[model samples]
Target chain A: MDKRAIGVFDSGLGGLTAVRRLHALMPQENIIYFGDTGRVPYGTRGRDIITKYARQDVAFLRQFDLKSIIIACNTVSAIALDLLSKENDIPIIGTVEPACRRAMTMTQTGRVGVIGTAATIRSGAYEKYLHKKDGTLDLFTQACPLFVPLVENGRVHRGDVVIETVVKEYLTPLKDAGVDTLILGCTHYPLLEEVIGDFMGPDVTLIDSGAEAANLASTQFDPNEGTGTTQYFVSDDPQGFNQLAELFLQEKVDVGAELVDISRY
Target chain B: MDKRAIGVFDSGLGGLTAVRRLHALMPQENIIYFGDTGRVPYGTRGRDIITKYARQDVAFLRQFDLKSIIIACNTVSAIALDLLSKENDIPIIGTVEPACRRAMTMTQTGRVGVIGTAATIRSGAYEKYLHKKDGTLDLFTQACPLFVPLVENGRVHRGDVVIETVVKEYLTPLKDAGVDTLILGCTHYPLLEEVIGDFMGPDVTLIDSGAEAANLASTQFDPNEGTGTTQYFVSDDPQGFNQLAELFLQEKVDVGAELVDISRY
Candidate 1:
């Protein structure tokens, strides 16, 4: 029974969705999280920068005795998962494939909508993965660039005009496309599930990509006694971490976090 | 008498506002601009991260024959101007002091409002500069964290409800405070000039900080015929550069740009 901690990270706090999922699925495993809050919205950046940041993030997490690493950021998962997975021997899980699989399984109409960051949508990772599995699947993709900042700023409530308006602007086309299954391709997108759900109606099944990946990772491990503290490390100052983490994790986590100079890694 | 290009850099395209001002004020001199679009919104990062990025940006520009450098980003101007100034013998200008001087001179009620990123507001650089200049001046500072993202997403038009709603949310208190002068502290702030001006009314003189810095730089140089090509370099791929630059530059210019891996510097 290997009890090494799981290393999960994202460009920012949005990865806490995956962390929350992991916490639920594998309550016994130690979880270490690194959020690159200092330099976020990796969605808009080019592939090289995203790859570089992903390397740095994984390297930082590699400092721990991690059995595995999770690319909780959809942008990284879409663009640099292969390069990251090859970096070490331990299994590396990305939030894309497991999510695509879930969407394919759930969609009876074979129509799937994927909404994510610009980079995630542009990478065509979800579309390629889904179409490869089932050639007849019809795929729709949209890049909701403003959603991350909106959710990060906590303007994500269903009735909020700003979030609702922005959500409608990005999601209307996908809704009209008659897609029965929608993938919340980015972890941050799930935070706006209420607004997106209210706009898309209950007919569309939304896939939480990060949680799906977390579930996949949980199924890989045997349950073990909880050991070691749930440690959090962030590239930015820890002052703003807990409040945002709580929002994404949906739980009151121990507020102690260490600040790291991630670039050195 | 200097003929070398003026090196101006921002974490992102927001500094193009300063470039526009420089281009207008000194059409003869070559203006070299570097936007670290890959790792942008430096305002939200910690002082050390911002400092490292500013140093990298300055180092990248230092590769060129630059007579002077302008810290067009208010976050960097507020936090790292002194450190950067110490780096080289060349005259370095930040967007803070000149704007503070202009705001102080323009204020009739001894009351001024400063709005910028959280870093800019938290740094208290503008307030300190103005207060140091005039002890009796009443200064109000607000941190509009969402403004950068909102403006970046091209929602700065005066009549748009999104821009108006956001502007009202941020500027109402400053308006109620009866400040006669408001500083558009960040370069991005000037992009939303029309929306901000409409919300604050024409009575409040808005200080365009980056423009003031550019104007100050222009005044320092004797008019020289246009030199070697006005080149642009960005950390991100040039595919998305020209479009956004045109948004902030406000003029049509030749868009040939070289992509640089800025982290190397």
Candidate 2:
């Protein structure tokens, strides 16, 4: 019954995939999205830094009257979600938990493969969550740090030679580990699903973290209450946000992003 | 002889290549390097945002009483170097002009290739500089935006299938044009030189922009006059900065980096 906007933030434009889902599922609830375009690819960074940045990101979004906050960046979700949830008053949902739940439902062999930034892999969030869901599940983890930059730079296409090459290299280890299900651990990894799909073959199921988070958000919030509008915000450049979002959403996003001084938060 | 440290700044660790060259040529000069690792990958952003960030980066170094400043980022050099030079009293040198000069000298067939970030290529600074030097030089330009991310993520080695594939895709047009000399217009590109070299074949000479900038700086300043001490500073994550620099520099960067709040500048 709440009409307030749901706040969502990511390291970069990959969160637009979540925004797209929110828009489709909750057309009546307002959405606030912030992409830290300036200081992106948070997955490669250290835990403390990611936590610090995530705090700032959430604090910035808090300036608006947000009902809930979504930590759309997987690295942040893995390392800082609990800290953020404990610190903030609003319901802070990270993509990790929701995506892990979805992965649990989709796995057949109980062997799950997870790919994300180095920090995410190091955190072992996916393995811990999958094991919690099913004690018998075997987890295979691979850190694909290059995927974020590749996606940000508009190399998400299936035939993109660079993406295809990197995907193969990243997936080979997990493929050899004989995992039946693969989790695109980072929000940005969904954009490379085609290349990843080709590398893992048809047998492996690809779980999109952003999509899972969006689905969870949809279940929690009632969409038919009112017409929900999306407001975009960025810490740095707002110019390329729309262009980058187009790749993820597969549609042109006309949303005008306001620039926010995230450091102030 | 002036003994003040030369200030060098980049969006991130890519500038270490310039620092590496400076260490080799001017071993005695004290160097102050500021990597905006917290808010890095300035290439894909807009000119105004890049200019603003570049100014803040320069200001951070100014606090150290620097003798000169090197704009190691190609996007900054291409778009904001002149603006920064006007604003600062200290001598400011950028990679663009020196790299362009070096490219002009190395191109044997008049057909020259330029590869950099999207913003760098869009600015057409190298093309303008090349034409200014010799109007007859045929310039071929391609924006290899993912190269920086690949380099930063430690995917730069030769025969690394991912980097090699990306290099081949990015260099195909220039290779088809029979470019005799290719300018690695961004500092990060130098890290991927091995893969770039393999893709471009042995005939094409690769111009490392950061190296040229260092050589230019060396000619103007005597490294022997300083204390040979180097200090590293970053906007966020000093530990990540140290690790990335060590990885990129291919040696232990003994100088500890201080985390400074760069947004203030």
Candidate 3:
């Protein structure tokens, strides 16, 4: 039995969805979360920048003496996970692999749809993983870059005209491609599930990346009582981070967030 | 006559709108631009984070021996410009004061509206400046955070249903408030000008923050030969930076962008 905290991080507060799930599954395991609030929305950026930021994020969590690290941002999970694992000694898990495995299991028709940030979709990480698992599966990918900012700004709802219209535009291509299962490729996309569900109709199955990652974390749980306390850190704006935590966890957590110079990591 | 480059920066590619104008207005002046592409969307973040990132951006540009600096991001200009200026020796200009000054001049009915990122609106910098300029003028403000990500991803045509719908949702409140003039308080908002114009109606004048900052940059122009060239630097993907540059400038520029370690600053 060991008691080290589980380290989870994302480009922003979206990763709290995973933290929320982890809390439910492993109630006693401590968590250390770092959201790069200052430089967020990592999905639309280039591969090199995403990799650099991911390394810094992992390094920040490493300082907490974490037993394992979870790269919760889909864009980073897709592009930088392999590089990060090679650089760190701890057990590292990214949202992409576990979510892809879950999607493969859920899909009966072997046809899948993926929606994420421009960079994540462009990386073809999901498609690559799915193809490696079954070589015959069909993949449809769409880049919904605006989804992150829209959800973060609290414009997510089934009846919200603006978000509804944008969701329709983004999902139309995927729906037309005739996929039976859709992966909410980015963690933030889960917040817009109601809007996405309305647009995709009832036939499509939705996969949540954060939920899958949480499931994976539960399987690898090391039951130890001494090291399971949760801690939170941010690169910028602790107040804004606290506010977004409410949306992800569906509860307000009053963790006095500390700002650290992320560049040094 | 100074031969040093005029340094300009933003949290991301939004500042390219100002750089585009500067290129047209002063063909001979050297330009050094830095866009923190990896950690962008500074408008939604908090003030302290914006200040820290802005300082690093400024310090990164200082390596080029810049004669002047322009903070083309409205959120940063509103919250961190004074702090950033005090941290650097170079002459610094920000979009807020220039855009606010222009808005004060353009409003005929004494009722002006401002739309920007949440942080910019929350700071109330434009409202304070407009009131200071003419106490009788009425100010209305709203935060349209998704506009930047939408513009960055190129969903910005007047005929684009998604953009038009989002624009309507963002502008309906300001339109109801009955303001004769509106400030596009963020530099990225200029890309959505056509959609915003259709939503707000032609009667309400729109102020482009980047254009105002460009006009301000013109006032500091030095008439020296061969010292003016555009040099671009970024913290992350130079390829994504160049692509965004094409969208904001609408003209292809062969800008050889170099990557810099911005967190050090």
Candidate 4:
């Protein structure tokens, strides 16, 4: 049984949601996480920049012996996954395809709503994967650009009027389209599930893309008996990441984080 | 007669406010501006990272034959100005000192309020400069972390509900302190002048830090007119910057923009 650590990374702290999911699915697998807090919110950036950053992120993770890499950032998954997968042999998993597959199965009606960062929505990666599975599926996509910052700043509670207002602004059109299954296309979006759920009402089923990808990764690997450990690395100062990481992961990152000059990779 | 272009750069499009000021103050001076759009919002990042990014930004601008360089971003000015000044023989101007000097003159009650990004506020650069000028002056500082994103997203209108709510949340304490002059310490804040002015009322005279810096830069330079022209460069794609640039500049950037991969420099 190969037991090299799984490398998971995001533009920022949101990827910890995927780590949380992996913990539930495979408790004995080692995880190495890198968050590019120095240059974050990849959702708003251009495609080339995202690809370059993703390449750097993967290269940084490759410093350690890694069996696989999981791109927990939806923006990177949408824009840079194919190129990144080809660059390395370690089976790279993106948060888009597995999520599309789950949404395909979960939908009662053919209608599916997708909400994510501007780049993720713009990439049309989810639609491409969803259409590949079933040609007849009706897809709706919305780019909620401000959601990441709102969630990152801890404005994601159930009753935060500001967040609720923003949720309504983004989800009302999707709700009106009568989509039965909605994909929380960005990992950070799941943090606002309560507010999103309240606005979308009980009829729509929301899929956490990061969690689905984590589950897919867990199923692909063989779990080892060694105690599961998490190592955290960030491009920014460790203190800032440590402070905000609580909002993303259920458990404290057992291994304290260290700073890395991500540009070198 | 100095005819070389004056180089000004910011973490993002916000620095265009300074360019706008320069255009008005010295109509016959050629200007070169670089915005690190791919890695924008240096205000949220750590000091060393900001310094590194600022150095790269300055280095990128140095590609042009520049007479002087303006640190139009308050975060960079607050954290990286001295280092950048030491590194370059070109006269380096920062936003903090100019704005503080203006506020010292504008405040009748000696009660001044400052609002900016977390890094800018944390640097305490404004307070330090202001205290050095007049030790008895009262200062109230608040870090409005969300303002940059809100402005960048074009949510800066006077009656925009989201921005108004956030403005109240951030400025109420400053108002309560009975401050007569408030410094719009970050360049982006000037875009929200209407909303901020509405919230603070006419009495709280707001000092635009970027404008002050631009004015300072304009005063220092001797203008020799062939023809005043503007050239723009960005770390990300030119298309994205071109799209959002109208929000910052009074007139269209006449020379258009070119993309530069900032990491190389």
Q: How does chain B score by TM in each prediction?
A: 0.97, 0.97, 0.96, 0.98
Task: Give the CA lDDT, 0 to 100, for residue B216 in model 2.
Answer: 99
Which digits, one per residue and each the tens of the lDDT, describe model 4 over residues B1-265?
8989999999989999999999889998899999999999898999999999999999889988999999999999999899999999899999999999999899999999999999999998888888888999999999999999988888898767788989999999999999999999999999999899998999989999999999898779776584888889998868878878888885665436888999999
The B-chain TM-score of model 3 reads 0.96
Candidate 2 lDDT over A149-216, as tens digits, reads 77776777877667787788778889999998898888888878788888889999999898888888
**Candidate 4, residue B192: lDDT:** 91
Q: Mind giving the per-residue lDDT tens digits that candidate 1 earns over A1-265?
A: 7888999999988898998888888888898999998778799888988999999999999989988999998999999999887778999999999999899889999999999999999998987888889999999999999998888888988667788888888888989999999999999988888889999999899999999999999888887687645788898867788767789878777657789888788
Which candidate ranks first by DockQ, i.e. highest?
4
1 or 4, greater by lDDT? 4
Q: List runs of model 1 lying over 4 Å from the truth.
A: none
The C-alpha lDDT values of all candidates are: 0.88, 0.85, 0.85, 0.91
Cα lDDT for residue B74, candidate 2: 91
Sorting all predicted structures by TM-score, with the top scorer first, yields: 4, 1, 3, 2
In order, the interface RMSDs are 1.3, 2.2, 1.8, 0.9
Per-residue alpha-carbon lDDT of model 2 for B45-83, expressed as tens digits? 877778888988988899887889999889899999889
Each prediction's TM-score against the native? 0.97, 0.92, 0.93, 0.98
**Model 1 Cα shift for residue A196 (angstroms):** 1.2
* Residue B58 lDDT in candidate 4: 90
Ten residues in sequence with the least summed lDDT for candidate 3 chain B: B220-229
Which sequence of candidate numbers ranks them by DockQ, best first? 4, 3, 1, 2
* Residue B42 lDDT, candidate 4, scale 0-100: 90
